[model samples]
Target chain A: MFNQMQLDILKEIGNIGAGNASTALSQLLNKKIEMNVPMVRILSFDEMMELYGSADKKVASIFLQFSGDLTGNMFFVLSVEKASTFIQQLPGLDQCSFVLPPYSEMAISAFQELGNIVASSYLTALSEFLRLSIIPSVPAVSIDMFGAIITYGLIEISKVSDHAIVIDAEIKDPFSKDKNGFIKGHFLLLPDPDSFQKIFSSLGVNQ
Target chain B: MIENGKTIKVGIADMKIAKAPDKLRTAGLGSCVGIILYDLHKKTAGMAHIMLPDSTLARGKTIHMAKYADTAVETLIRKLEEVGVRKVTLRAKIAGGAQMFQTASKSEIMRIGPRNVEAVKKQLEKYRIPIIAEDTGGSNGRTIEFNPENGVLTIRTVNLGIKEI
Candidate 1:
């Protein structure tokens, strides 16, 4: 049950998770970055089904895994145009071309590295906040279909449980990790409902 | 683009761009909703491009700080009032509410355009400001520019292939 306390707990959890995610993405990009997590709320399945528009394009999709001490599966969906935007902003990859196929491997590596960082950081933060340990499964990266990618995660997580808590966090990707940087990326946190509450409570907010 | 005139570049969702006649001449609008609220009486034009539906969901105050439909419209009206724009004389023309990005899920987060459109319409009625014209919805981003005196609206889109919905 995601009561008031739970919402607060989830918000804090997202902040920590986003930090970890930023660390990972920053390393891969070889540039300092920051994450700005937005407010988290528990939505019904119906709400999730509605509201969002369809895919803008089929070119590039960003994939990640959402794992915690509890249970949940979630993926990140981004367009190639967006990915291009991200890559273009990311450092080191400055030499990389925006072309496809050959760049696919580079893109996958970036995604996986980001996944590992965020997953590890989220679990680590949740464990510290709850005083429990969590280990995320190995992340698999690919570039095919957005529907297929999101659907696969939804199914994989659903198989283990029916009820899940999602934390919709928006991260601000700063070109430089240090101060004097503008927000350039969004970091989202999708957690299972149970743990989501615990984390929210810690933030001192009603769930 | 640089010029003697002031150009306030409005961003996605609930940000208003306003400048005095000798100050602002152009304001850029994107996929997000842009409510061009003007006062013919005062010759003042104020624009707000909001991303989300309401500010209730927001955490804190933003720089431009018109995060919600109701609040943004209210603020614009208040500003116009200060500049000697009469309430009855105030009118509006809205543009940009494209579903720039679509997904099979169709989450409420993306339907922001329609929801924002509705929110703005409701607020306008509450303020008693007549919406003379509006071009919203569909799947294309738009750029709108308005000159306070002439009150002439120049609308443009990215033209990503398909016609705007």
Candidate 2:
């Protein structure tokens, strides 16, 4: 139950956070990265799955849970191909294969670190902007079905409502000329239902 | 007569029924559980993709019956009965309930997979239904399909490929 103004505020928050994350990523890989304006939508569980292509689509996801003034879950999701591409960019991991399990420890760690850097930058920007103390848990990496990984973030929200407020930011690598771009990923922010009040109050906006 | 070779899909917090020559399927079960209540004699089955353990946790105005283990089981059984299937002849097969991400935090929400499995078992016991088979409590996501005609449940995982229970 959010008005247009409230939704705009959340979108702006996503925009700033994603901007910082893309900058961090570009620095790490020495590649030009582009991010679109974040989209804020309240959607049902089924609709949320569809947004990511489908429930069974395989993905590489980095998950983190944040606590403080505004508690919520954050996800950095990439397609299997995109994940491998990013992983290969890391030093000495050019031969890493992320297509199947029994994945090498070095590859996994490299991917995790990549996620860690980008997510930390994103959260840092948000924390500064909102003037809220936010602490993020250690990043956890998983390669699985998109629906399965993403639904983990929905557990807390599902208790309160069937619908969730998803702030989705899409980031892409500009160098690749593929039909869908070279490296594309999504940073999804799902704040717990109770945390909405704290966020609104911090912004001096009535919910 | 049944619709041959058609699969009825059950979405998260949703439910559906299928008859002989037809199947019921649900995809991407992370910490969620999929429960199937079927009657062999009637060649019919009902499936629910449950997201939470109980309806009491619902803070919203309207409760989605298929979203909770307690309510989903009851509602599925009732729906199966409406299709001329006897409650006493009903058997259950369940799957999904995975801890997709490993975290040091021991919050109850983090262990929801096991909790969901337990809640579903409790509901089935309350209804006097015997569990025929189950594939649960792994740290991997599962896509499950149930064939009412042959009473076979098929489970697929990203790492383990596919298996039938």
Estimate the TM-score of every prediction: 0.47, 0.95
Q: Which stretches of candidate 1 lie over 4 Å from their true place?
A: A1-207, B1-4, B11-31, B54-65, B155-165
lDDT (Cα, tens digit) per residue for candidate 1, span B1-165: 333465665533334445445222222232346788876556677887654456665543342345457778888888777767767788888876554444343445445567778888888999888888887886554556666655766665433322221
All candidates' lDDT scores? Answer: 0.53, 0.89
Candidate 1's TM-score: 0.47
Chain A vs. true chain A, TM-score per model, equals 0.65, 0.95
Q: What is the C-alpha lDDT profile of model 2 across B1-165, one tens digit per residue?
A: 555789888999999999988899999999899999998888899999998999998888889899999999999988988888989999999998888877787877778988999999999999999999999997899999999988999999987799999
* Residue pairs clashing, model 2: none
lDDT for model 1, on a 0 to 1 scale?
Answer: 0.53
**Candidate 2 residue-wise lDDT, A1-207, digit = tens:** 788889899999899999999999999999988999999989999988767676977888999989988889999998877888888888999888777887888998899999999999999999998899889889999888889888878888987888889889999886553355432798999999988877788899989
For residues A1-207, could you state the per-residue lDDT of candidate 1 as single tens digits? 656555565676667766666676666667666555556644432233221322112333343444444555444444444455565555566555322445645755665566556656656766676665465555554343232233323322232333234665555444333242322343434554355445444445555
Cα RMSD (angstroms) for every candidate in the order listed: 11.7, 1.8
